[model samples]
Target: MRRVERALLSVSDKTGLIDFARGLSELGVELISTGGTAKALADAGLPVKNVSDVTGFPEMLEGRVKTLHPMIHGGLLADRSKPEHMSKIAEHGILPIDIVVVNLYPFAATVAKPGVTWEEAIENIDIGGPSMVRSAAKNHAAVAVVVSPSSYDGVLNELLRNDGKLEAETLKRLAGEAFAHTAAYDATIAAYFAKKLGEETESILPAKLTLSFEKAQDLRYGENPHQKAAFYREAQGGQGVASARKLHGKELSFNNIYDLNAAYNLVQEFAGEKDPTAAIIKHTNPCGIAVSTTLADAFTKARAGDPISAFGGILATSRPIDAATAELITGKNTFFEAIIAPGYDEDAFKILTEKKQWGANLILLEAEFGAEAAGENIDIKRVSGGILVQTEDKHAVGRADLTTVTRRGPSDAEIADLLFAWKVVKHVKSNAIVIAKDRQIVGVGAGQMNRVQSVRLAVEQAGDKAKGAALASDAFFPFADGPEAAGIAGVTSIIQPGGSKKDGETTEMADNYNIAMVFTGHRHFRH
Candidate 1:
């Protein structure tokens, strides 16, 4: 037999409560509510029977003991189709509830405030709310559970179409969401307690840490066509391009993700600075990065890094996109996948969107991510299940750390460029080599099998531009062969973290070639 329509309404958030109650009333569904909900329904000019009226007990202990009674649970939990459960409910004069609309107290919000006391936080934890939700979810075969305000409209539509009845499949899906909601709540509570009182700062036991992240979006594909991938975002705040607001464009691709991350990390160094800069990224590395008085000039120098790679790359700037810079970018036939900045000029948008094929490929985002200090630890990875985690390589080649091993000293301009190259090399995969001229990348050799080969490859890519350029290595030169390769290719100055046993040999080789060299006393081996 079909059960009579009834609903149990208990909610702390009163958003759309009156309208929801009124809709249920229009369907001739009896509303049984506890405490505040009953008062709210009564104020809305709708009839509501108090929970105490059905349970036959008055609310005690300042409303804490309102809905934790046997009569309410028995009616909500009884199987309506079973004759024995129905007979018992009839004998006890209990009215079955076909729907439950509930939302928990604001425990997370209460504790989020500054200087909140433990007593206040404990008081906000609702016991009866979660219990009622669980009972309704467990017996969803005969009841509809509505926990989210977002689901209120859908539930109302279902009732409007079916005359206050819901399909079995819809009920089951709502129940699943209810369980997930409670599980996440309990996990947050457990993590908070362990962080505040139960756990020590440094314990080296084999601890299992489960991080829960929700899906941000589904990507077009993974790094390769055969692989599958999706993007997940942290629930808490700290993020970069992962949390950026996409003002325009289609879904981001795998290559777009790689380049955008690199560009985003680089531009953060200059975020909000009066001196503007531009960074162009390709294949998870910086092909062009430069700072200038104007963003257009910076982009010009940055694009000179590797024009071939920049053809289909991603661009990020520290300032707003101006008309001149936008014209410079849009005038080219180069196929850029994405562009991000603090904002865009109206004329700039006009030029980009007016193009024939611009709408399909171009993506623009608004983000202002500033450079923050790195964490104490860093993590690196390798193929075949190899992992490395340690303190970050924060050592930079300061002027005091340099030891002039060569007879010829570097010019002041050469020294400045050498420092710039050194900074760029650290972020590249090892064994890394970088060539710089006038504070911009000329050629970068990264992820090579050997140090000498990486140096040779960087110089080869630099070609005729290797003359008068400064070079930086991720680690110390193991032998003089690396310097020899650079010397033959016309590199003038070099910087490296020198702890090598063959340091004297390399110094002699640099002196023989009349090239200036400095030992930075630090290494930045990424892998």
Candidate 2:
């Protein structure tokens, strides 16, 4: 442990600067600052020496040239462990800085602003702050680095508890955090430049990908009870499931987070639509999905798709949960593990929180914002030795993208059902099949071994409802058995990608069975 005698303080976020400086002053520590930070400390009635005063040079270039002098860095980098290192700094009339308090400029926040110019974003990037942080962190055996306002209280408490000295372990932890803070800051800058430089769509993946994350929470276990797990949130774009605010119920488990993320993502697919939408997900595949005139009706119809699977599953809705919707959800004895949405009406919140059964344990997460879409338009999967990266499957087949392949064209109602089923199938697992009627998912067969098996599974689930329903296959059928199964189930219309050698056979079968078949020309295969 080393006694802290001097602290260099220069930060863009001055959250706890006053209180922390006062605490250090009480410990007989000298305060050194730059520019606005110096002015703020002096205004707070704390004695502070300006960096220009210490270096005997004035800040230049519109305040960008402050704290770049060797006087500041040499003090932070000096090794007190060596007698010569301390004597050399003293001989040069330099005082060693024991702590560095700094936080970089808000490059991420500035770039996120609407209509922000390139000049503004470039200006917000801090050069000297990161340099000072790195210098102090690199010499953390003797120096302590503080990079966030949130660390002020704990650091101050430690300094007071130890009579102005920080333990070696504390120094190491602070240094690690300082490095991560600078890394995340630099990563944000690099990504912004990549966007501004306009990398061609053909070169979507960068030569090197640097990702930064911070631990959000530690879970009880992972996918299985025996596995360890934790949640790490992205440094930038702090939205979606990672940013969700839990309004009620028990803490989220590992599987609960995954299911909530799945439900949240699928619900975002229908954002800003005319009708209210709801989806229930089981094991990351949505079992029930529907859009209806009313929020209550949407939830009711969605649950009707597969109430057995919907039990204890994750539920998500497009709009806020209204009183009627809340009543409908709790009306049945069935229970859901969690529900995520934009918000909840006051009455709805009360009813759900105070429900008769399973209410106390039901997790309620309120997104509270637009909850617009999935963050980061790319997909990443871990493999045995390396990783696979691909662009997100955001493609949607509009009505104009459809081509009638069979002799009979789908009726207007069948077209609506086909489009609805098309959207749902894209989110299901590979070899997926969806049966929809009147904008409600009647059945979903996902992750089957073969396309024909998926078709049969969906038809069986739909039962009587399959008679007039529209079916959507995520990919083209390799054999006519899929269409033949749909035909025997009395399916009236079908939508698929239609790019197989046996497309001729499938088309012939559809024509023979009077099933209106259309090719979307796009395959949505999820794995």
Candidate 3:
């Protein structure tokens, strides 16, 4: 244990400062502070010595050069066990500082505000605070560093119990926390600068990538029941599953959250439309999706697309939930793991909670939609040894992006269904196939190892409904087998990226079957 005789305190967040300082003063420890902290302590009737008196140098550069002197750093960094270090401090008349408490300026909060100038942000960057923290943390055996107000009560209890001394283990833990605090602070500043530079140069990738996340929840288990799991939200706040508000139902499981994310993202694709859109997700893949003039119709068509897979699935909509939709969702032979929408009417909420017994187990979430949704987010996937980061796949195939390659061109109605199927296929897993008619997905095959198998699965699921429906592939067909399978299933049109070496063969097969094919020149492969 190391006894704390003298301590330095400088903080931007002065929470619990008075009580903590008073406790330290009662223990006969000398308190030294700078600037506003010193003034605040003195006004509270506590014995406080100004840092200017200890260093014998007045603060200059508008209080920027207050604590950078040798007297301050040497006092904190000197090794008490070393005879040479003690002799140098004694020869220089430097008093040893046993504890250092500091929290840096609010650089993260300052830059987050709108219309913040570079001059203002640069001024908020702390230098002296981080220096003292690192110095004390580096000499953890002889010094105790405190960086958060949350640790104040714990430290005070320990100090009181140990007669104003801190244990070496406690000091080591505090030092580790101090380093993490500085690391996160520096990462935020670096990200801000990188964004500014990228905007000016029109560059997408930064020279170095820095990310920070805060723990959101600890789940009961991971994908499997035996694995550990936790949820983390990005330090930079945005709208999505992470920002959703739980309105009803039991706690969300790990698999439920995963499927919720996939379902919500798929529904957001129709945010700009006035029509109601519904998407059903199973195991992070879209089982059914539809858009209609009414929410009830949307739910009916979406659920009809694949009733077997839609059972116990996650349901998401681009509009509010009303009475008619609530009744359809909670009716007999209909069940869902979760329901997500922008809002829920009073009658609808009551019916969902009181009318159906199974509703108690359904997770209900209210999320932001349309213009309020998050903008231009990054997608991250963890591989075996590292992570792969890329910009989100937000590319939508417009009329201009579609190139007619078949002898027969697509009709207006077929073109609309092609666009709708294209959007749904983008969210499906790699080697995906989607068949849709009138903006409603009739069948979807996802995560297959081969493209032809995926197409066959989708066509088989569609059955008689495959007639006159458009087909969408996440990527180009490697051979003519995929298009031939779709043609045999009675598919009227197909849309895919046209970058494969056998694109000519695929086009010839489409022409032979009198099917319309459009090339998007872009592929979406979600692994």
- lDDT of prediction 3: 0.91
CA RMSD of each candidate after superposition:
4.8, 1.8, 2.8
The number of the candidate with the highest lDDT is 3
Model 2 lDDT tens row, 166-277: 9889999999999989998888787666655534354456766666667899999999999999998866664689889999999899999999988988887787688889
TM-score of every model versus the real structure: 0.79, 0.96, 0.90
Tell me which of candidates 1 and 2 scores higher on TM-score.
Answer: 2
Give the poorly placed runs of model 3, Cα more than 4 Å off.
14-29, 36-48, 247-249, 346-361, 372-376
Q: Look at candidate 2 and tell me the lDDT of residue 36.
A: 89
lDDT, candidates in the order shown: 0.80, 0.89, 0.91
Winner of 2 and 3 under TM-score:
2
